[model samples]
Target: MTETLADFRRRVADFLAHHGCPAGAAPSRSRRPADHVAAARVHQRALADAGLAGITWPVEVGGLGLGPEYRQAFAEESAGFETFSAVFTIGLGMCGPVLLALGTADQRSRYLPPLLRADEVWCQLFSEPGAGSDLAGLTTTAVPDDDGGWRIRGQKVWTTYAHHSDRALLLARTDPGKAKHRGITMFVLDMTAPGVTVRPLRQATGDAEFNEVFLDDVRVGPDDVVGAVDEGWRAATLMLMNERVALADNPIGSPVTLDAVVALANRTGRTTDPVVRKAVADAYVAQQQAELFARRIAGEVRVGRDPGALASIGKLAAGRLATQVSALALEVAGPDAVAWDPADPDGGLWAYGELYAPSLSIAGGTEQIQRTVLGERVLGLPREPQADRDVPFRELRRG
Candidate 1:
């Protein structure tokens, strides 16, 4: 008999408990990026072998061929523990599903298993310095090469784990004469190609979790295209939708939770203080509301509905909750939050959370972008006027 979702969850919890969770801080302290990536690969490989890594994926692609509920079960089980899932975030959450949605059979067969097993890692090349939330403005170009392949040129910024990735899902302008959002193409490119460069970008938390990637004459074959040429906007839109879904479901509200904040207040003897108490209560309410939004998005996904507008709205709510929780954590921790005792093991997490909280607004999509999406898509409001929406990309003026 096949294992049910509950049994699968129990088995996953047991394996993780027995084998030990991903080291609480191994990646941050690793001397080399390769070492950190290797550790993550090993843990992910173990998860895949245990039938827990790609619960919602087809069995032919190194998954259990289970439904989304099984994936949800695993997610719920794993949320309470530390896991080195950061390295696989793009591949599993966005790229893998996108491939499932638009990739040819050969591409899916060739890439999915290795990614699910963590033998290879992937990064997204979407945003550029000039076009983050407004990703359609990206100017990276992919021109036809002599060998019937594409030669890429330009830079990508804020790419997570690009420095350690083996492949990248790239978006580039294929026909600049078309409108900005049109004439774009998405392709899978080898990160190890001769002209590809990955440079780490350090964050406010002092961790180089993201990178700037430069591609010059990087070649990818016609077979590498993910969707119909010049129709990559559809693929990109789907990936961004998944990105919001993944980020929305993250339980770490600004890397801290209401329970943690409440516990901190109690430990600091501030729980009885009216101000702190009220903050905690309000935070609990906010987090709960955000969670409801997340659940609604998740339910849509589970039932084969596109998150659509809910992705934007849910992401905004989650970002706000995360921001609020981060503030509440700092208030509860008081002086100890910013500067921590070196001796305490959790000293870094609090400081890191405080520093990283601000990024929730920027990642996935900015708050303003989310609100705009909600206004236009969900509320049926007219889109704000744009000066260049219909102009040819090459004709648009840029700084």
Candidate 2:
């Protein structure tokens, strides 16, 4: 029997009320990464037990095998409450989707169940020292071993939560003799393997939410390869598309809302200023616009349609909106935002949001990258001329 949307919404709301963290219950940004991960695992296990997690995944992998609309409904219902989803965002939203789309049957069966229940965590190993914006130009190398496996050696920077991840979807150059993009391969890397090192990178927000990873001849079995060898670009493209959508639909990390910003304005007596009022109004409208666009993109995915460039649009809007809302909150916070009393622990929320705002634009995909995708992919514009597009990666100049 198919459950109606209203019934699903009620079920989600009831579950969240019992198990969800109330909005503003804690300063999420101030929480340690390990603390967040621990709480999220607990929350996810409970949600999975109640058939709320993996709302759109297949039944064979312990999901309810529901439609995408159910997932969308859950997102809408759970938006106001902190579901502790940040820790598993890369696993569930990005890696899980990629595995589902291109993974072998064995890979899907082995990984998806644990991921849905938050029994494991995942991260992405795509951004390298040389491949932040130009991911295809990465220098990471995976050499074939005598055991029919591979040994990876490279560095990946800005890896979110690598310190705690159980696995990661890694991209490396398997055939540098081919063109940069054509030579790449994706693998499911075991984070606990030998020669793998994770070093946390403390951001300006005083949070170690990102990390830089080093792989010193880390061994990966043939079973760990995702998609076909030397053809990972297709799988990578799918993941990136899903990443933009996920970043849009799910505010994975600690996100500040307009309501909180407005309340700060009211408390600080800034609401009376004409300029402040106008900025608040503008922020509200922008929030609505971004939300509506996200919903539209979700609808397309619900029907099994690829969002493609539309995901980029939502991502761009979300990135801009994060900065706009957080900046407004900081402005309203005035002196307290800069230096709050030590006794008042929550007083620095606005400051944290302000510092975290810049990363929102930079993460997932940059504003400039998103715009380039939109212009070239959506508007049917001419492709950017890369002088090294057809050149072999081994022969390319290094920084």
Cα error, residue 231 of model 1, in Å, equals 1.6
- Positional deviation of 271 in candidate 1, in angstroms? 2.7
Candidate 1 Cα misplacement greater than 4 A, ranges: 1-14, 20-36, 248-252
Model 1 RMSD vs true structure: 2.6
* Candidate 1 TM-score versus the reference: 0.90
Alpha-carbon lDDT of model 2: 0.84
In angstroms, how far off is 124's CA in candidate 1? 0.3
lDDT of 2 by residue, 55-125 (tens): 78888988878887787788778876876556766899889999998999999999999999888999999
Error of 1 at 268 (Å): 2.4
Backbone clashes, candidate 2: 0
lDDT of 1: 0.81
Error (Å) of candidate 2 at residue 329 is: 2.8
